[model samples]
Target: MRNPLNLKAPAAALAASLALLAACQSTETKQETTATTVPAETSKTDSAAGPKFLSQPLVKDIYTADPSAHVFDGKIYIYPSHDIETGMPENDKGDHFAMNDYHILSMDSVGGPVTDHGVALAVKDIPWAGRQLWAPDAAFKNGTYYLYFPVKDKQDVFRIGVATSKTPAGPFKAEATPIAGSFSIDPAVFTDTDGKSYMYFGGLWGGQLQRWQKGTYDANAPEKEPSGDVPALSARVGQLSADMKHFDGPVQDVKILDEAGKPLLASDTKRRFFEGSWMHKYNGKYYFSYSTGDTHLLVYAVGDKPTGPFTYKGVIMEPVQGWTTHHSIIEVKGKWYIFYHDTQLSGKTWLRNIKVTELKRKADGSIETIVP
Candidate 1:
């Protein structure tokens, strides 16, 4: 039977290419100078103090979620899944299944309000964008920006696509139609220290890893299937060409960890051992963070490499007030922080708000999440 998805290049080559492209773009642009500030430690005397962590609302009125932040030209540019609620109701397919527009929000500081830069990229602009445009991940390389995103056709089937722009906040143009093949969502692009690039996706179809080869869009090429069951969630890493359009090797599965830095097993009944894979390297070790269970508890693991033999680090943050969380981790100014979405302000699931908080690594190499 033929797989319904189209994929280009083996997993490794594709990752390498993305890294190169991001690096090249970084070199061409001036680095943003506005330093992201970490909040001072809360005083024990302040009994009424709210959660120690707080995130300034970036975009308002419009329901914006799944934010990815990148610094460009002295500003923090956020690319988020955009929806239209104020204008002519552009109903692509009924109200609930409407498509999205990728918009860029800029701020001078991490805690600053995100200013609207308008629509950075949109579905109608891409050739194969049938309707749904979800999860936009951006990387800069060689004076150009690569915005990778997941799109669905009129049928609501998902595929990945790449777009290029000269600036982070840009009029990005699609490079190709949904990258050949694949039915995946939550596309993440990463570039490693050795200049290798990788792309990871696959939550619903279990976890899959593919390498990108030059001049091809075959995600299965040089395929390396994951050793374990499709993690309730999983992430893959690989090397990419400097150009950011090709791959150099195979994609590998990353491991989940417990608080003591031990591996955690996914419950066979899908009770939430793993989901939502996010990665970052600090202090010579790579940290892989993910969500668990329907409650969306946060957990992490540490590894020597992007791909693991990782030691589980345990729960970083648990669902608050019965609210679930989806998050990403980033390091700024040598401090680690967690960026996650929650139902604090808007109880509606679709209206969940994004939050950021300082994360402290214990002497044991585990993280303590501060609630905001």
Candidate 2:
């Protein structure tokens, strides 16, 4: 049976689905002014004897994936997709990932207990959303917290949305509609050193990026990869308006090129951009990383500017035990960490759990590939 994108089931049916997801589910209570302790397990890795899992699932009660972690006010805040057990058969279109809401997670330090701030945002709360609340990101501006996410509108086209709250953990109120020109998934908002912010977004395959080849959405376009011989699709980057809600200008292509200055072709699945766009600055250079969806590897490229003609660097992570790999990198207290997910908790790709491990870089600033 095809899963309904809007999640507009009968009350009883919806309750049952929620019940199936209740194990690790957090409450839907009002937002709190102070952080509250939720049941979370600290890392089980022993430094003396290296373990196979760099770190255990930060969340076990409720499944979480595609972690977008950031350090704010001396604590780490994680914005992740809240996975659920939807029995719809898995497909390339990600039908089984029928998540309708999001839960924000936080911790004071690495290896410390995590806290799940329940139901920061939900489908029913957003006026324009249809379903499949995929991976999301968070940013702290002047004094408010902004949450950027991708959801299919009532028309079933993916578009980016924004919600806001005074606290990092939110019972957020969403804007009536999505960002005007935004179309596609995995919205990563990167604030540069000069205090300007840019949003990088796009995804291929079921992400419906191929439909936007002419820079506008074409619903009739086929949902398939481009010809292997052609240059692969590029992700997009646009400067955020001063309000942090809209785009200041039209988005430009973020091209990842080979060492020989050639654009990666669709046939080069191992290196071409797929879904999961992330940007972080290291040593004054912009590092753009993403998941090679079908290839299952997390790779990166580097450029001098935020909107880049980046040169492919190398793999950041080998394939994890999952069909898809999505991630984020952040520096905390002089050390860097990578937050990603796999199906270790449930052994099912759609129902995944997020994990974190320290990241190491060579003296020349190149990242050491993580063999998770």
Tens digit of lDDT per residue, candidate 2, span 1-372?
111222133454335435645644433233333345655555564233433466678876678999999998899999999887767887768878888888898999987878877778998889999999998999989799999999999999999999999989897889999999999999999999999999999998778888898878998888776866899997989999989999998998899999999999989989999989999999899999999888788999999999998999999999886687899999999999999997655556777789999999999999999988
- Top model by TM-score, which number? 2
Error of model 2, residue 16, in angstroms: 20
lDDT of 1 by residue, 214-274 (tens): 3333444432322354443345455556776554665555555544554444343222333
CA lDDT, every model vs. true structure: 0.55, 0.85
Which candidate tops lDDT? 2
Q: Which ranges in model 2 have alpha carbons more than 4 Å from their true place?
A: 1-22, 25-51
TM-scores of the models, in the given order? Answer: 0.69, 0.90
Q: Looking at candidate 1, what is the lDDT of residue 63?
A: 47
RMSD in Å for all candidates: 12.6, 6.0
